[model samples]
Target: MGFCNSCGRPIVKEDYGTNKDGSLNDEFCCDCYQNGEYTEPDITLEEMIVRKTKEMMAKNDRLPETHATAITATFIPGLKRWNPEFQDDYKTL
Candidate 1:
């Protein structure tokens, strides 16, 4: 299994995103990408971190808000969508 390039969620075949041509895109998860585009293309890394942190806490009730935020902040920037080097290529696709 690989992780989603956007949300860092674990991805299996079923969770893979779709390309514009409808082929499976192994780099991302369905929720974060579709039709070869980000579901929330306008979202910035900071916004993503905040959103994921909230979602993480909500989904895993035992996780604290601070920990969730920390986790997301630590990893989200390394994602293909947010990483500066990959951002240009990702958008062009």
Candidate 2:
């Protein structure tokens, strides 16, 4: 029941991506990572936040845009893929 590192969606086994060696990549979801590569490698943190906020609004009509933005802003940075140190350590991964 862990969440996706990219979009914050609940992760199931099928949602996990494959690693370089074809093993499961537990940290990221299939939409964010495939074949050990980022689907949107050039996307900035702010862009991800904006995109996900829209999706959140669409998925839950009661969730206001402002609240979605706030939630994404607060949550994304803590995900493994968005962590500054983690990014710095594995810029290519």
Candidate 3:
């Protein structure tokens, strides 16, 4: 059976989301998605946690120092393709 990406619980058979490439996510269930649980098919388990932590920190106005949060520079080259905001040319706050 599939499992929830955020909580790692068994996902209901019908709750799988779509993958980045359009395949079935087979990770998160609908209940989790509807319950504000993190859901994604592109990022991995660890990546999701890190991203969520960063988001939390930003929301709380406590962004961690550079050394505290490892910047995955290698991701920029690929992430920029899907998320333009990550591009240097893009203007974001």
Q: Candidate 1 residues 1-93, lDDT tens each?
A: 999998888999999999999999999999989998889898888888988898899899999888888899999999887788887895586
lDDT of 2 by residue, 5-84 (tens): 87677898989987878898877899998888889899988999999899899999999889999999999878877887
TM-score of each: 0.83, 0.85, 0.28
lDDT of 1: 0.90
Alpha-carbon lDDT, every model: 0.90, 0.85, 0.48
TM-score of 3: 0.28
* lDDT (10s digit) by residue, model 3, range 8-69: 44566677755445555554555334433334435554564466456646766665645324
Give the winner by TM-score.
Answer: 2
Highest lDDT: give the candidate number: 1
Q: List the candidate 2 regions with Cα displacement exceeding 4 Å.
A: 88-93
Query: Local error of candidate 2 at 5, Å?
Result: 1.5
Per-residue error for 65 in candidate 2, Å, reads: 1.2
Q: Rank the candidates by lDDT, best first.
A: 1, 2, 3
**On a 0 to 100 scale, what is the lDDT of residue 75 in model 2?**
93
